[model samples]
Target chain A: MSNQELDVLRSKVDEMNGQLLQLINERAELVQEIGRIKEKQGVNRYDPVRERSMLNNLLEKNDGPFERSTVEHIFKEIFKAGLELQEDDHRKALLV
Target chain B: MSNQELDVLRSKVDEMNGQLLQLINERAELVQEIGRIKEKQGVNRYDPVRERSMLNNLLEKNDGPFERSTVEHIFKEIFKAGLELQEDDHRKALLV
Candidate 1:
């Protein structure tokens, strides 16, 4: 590819990466909110059955080049991170 | 901090980061192996109850400057990432 074309492609990739980061951060924020709700309700932050159900639901909905197992793995990590944020918030409160 | 001290600190931080990365990757590999086993056994990849139990166990074990909740959160994210790697491996196999 020409230098200019390469530059444009790089920029596009960077932009896409930025968008993904933003989406991931937003999702994290949502998870934190859920954590707060759970804490207030005296509910546990981790729910494996709900997580499995989510994965299965997503797998059923998936029709892609990406395999269902791969999708499940990615989503599971994302969900795990969300739970972490919630735990972090709770910990901070305890420290105060 | 003195310049030499700062340099030493920075190096230590970098070394710690590297160690963490290595550990994370190692954990990911283990998860991938588990995924393969699960696949053979027709088991689900995501297990929320187990995750919750883990978090609680960790919390009970924690006696540190880091809060139990924070510990839980970090571990949850790590576990989640491991699951993702496993799924990714499974997906690749399916595509072949």
Candidate 2:
């Protein structure tokens, strides 16, 4: 019974991983689009005020088994990923 | 010029936020599915070994500006969210 149980959950986790991969890629695409616009406008890649507000808004809306601090931290990393994408695009634009 | 640049980036951020919201909800849906399966199978909601493996897999695949530790931390919170959903499902089954 325990073996079957573990197998079932593992399968589910694998499936969740795939869904997460897709969503993250979708997010990356949007990040790239935003990065293009940022490059065209000659704007700073990281916007601290906007990021702070986004984190605050997410924290306010959080109803969670996950704590607000955890969300804040994870989201900062996510935002960093977006910034990195923007930086990569900026670098490419410079090369061209 | 600076004001226009900030305004443009803010609009993009807003769009990204909407995309992120959709992705998180999609993740939550998968978590609920796994939770229902766990409830039916009478399994422990938290699986440390599997969670560890998932984090490790993600870390291994990460080619990022986001550090491995950051991914590990975020994933743990995401995993916690999954566990909470399972716990909630377990509780509902008990009440039924």
Candidate 3:
């Protein structure tokens, strides 16, 4: 009974992970789109002010099984990943 | 015109960020639930094989401006964060 219960919960986690994958990729595409606009306008792709505000906003919205700190940590990683996505082709080529 | 375009894109990004924030919290809740069930069964909360399998599955789903490594990297950070969410209360309390 216990093993079966674990399997059910684990599958639900798997489903959520897939949903997360879709959302992260969707967010990535938006980040890339923003990067393109910034590039064309000769503006920096990453704006720390924008990042700080977004983080603050997310923290405010957080009501969680996870703490505010945990949410902040994960979102910051996501933000960093998105910013890094906008780097120059040469750098990306080197990394890949 | 360029500034206006940026505003639109930035707003979209903000909306997406909000959505991501909600989804991350939801996923965290599921993780905690799974932790509860595992505890009841006297099973360890973290299963690295399951983690690796999820990573492989995410990599397969990757079709992107972000490289495979980048997806893997971001997902690994997320996975680590989720796993930490299941850690002992003493460790979490100390961190908090």
Candidate 4:
């Protein structure tokens, strides 16, 4: 009984993982597009104000089993990686 | 021309961020459900084999503006965070 329940939950987790992978990649592409636009406009890619506004928007919308701080931390990591993507040099992946 | 283009792309990025936030939280909820089931069954919550398989599945599906390595790295961080959420003693939010 419980075994079947566990299997169902595990499969759902797998489905969620697939969805997350797709969404995060899609977000990355959008970030890259923005980076290209910024480059054309001679603007800095890392706009802390814009980043802060975006983070606030996310935090506002986050209704989570995960805590607010955890969500913020993960998004900041995602945001940092996106910024790193924008740079021409130093595109090393975070291996931790 | 470029300024207007930038606005459009930035808004799209914001939209993506919102969607990603929802999906990630949803995933976390599913993880918590699985954790509860595992606890009831007296199984170790952190299954490295399962984790490796899940990571490989995501990597296989990764069609990315981010490199495959980068995608893997980000997902690993996410997986680690998920694992942390499952623990009773160490739910300290990753403030990174």
lDDT of 1 at B53: 64
Put down candidate 3 lDDT per residue, A1-96, tens digits, no spaces: 867876787788777777777878888888887787777677877788999999899888888766888788888888888888888542664586
lDDT of 4 by residue, B1-92 (tens): 98888889889889988888887878877787788787767789899999899888888888877777887787887878788788842333
Listed for each candidate, the true contacts retained, as a fraction, are 0.00, 0.13, 0.79, 0.88
TM-score (C-alpha) between model 2 and the true structure: 0.59
B2-39: candidate 2 lDDT, tens digit per residue: 45765675666666565554455555666676667666
Please give, as one word, the docking class of candidate 3: medium
Cα deviation at B55, candidate 1, in Å, is 1.6
Candidate 1: segments with Cα more than 4 A from true spot? A1-96
| lDDT of residue B10 for candidate 4 | 87
Reference-based lDDT, residue B38, model 2 = 65
Give Cα distance to truth, residue A80, candidate 4, Å: 1.5
Ranked candidates, highest lDDT first = 4, 3, 2, 1
Candidate with the greatest lDDT versus the true structure: 4
lDDT winner between candidates 2 and 4: 4
Worst 10 residues of 3 chain B by lDDT: B87-96
- Model 2 misplaced stretches (Cα beyond 4 Å): B1-96
Candidate 3, residues B34-90: lDDT per residue as tens digits?
776776677887888999998888788878766788778877877777778878542
lDDT of 2 at A19: 54
Better of 1 and 3 by TM-score: 3
Say which docking band candidate 2 falls in: incorrect
Q: Candidate 4, after superposition: displacement of residue A66 in Å?
A: 1.2
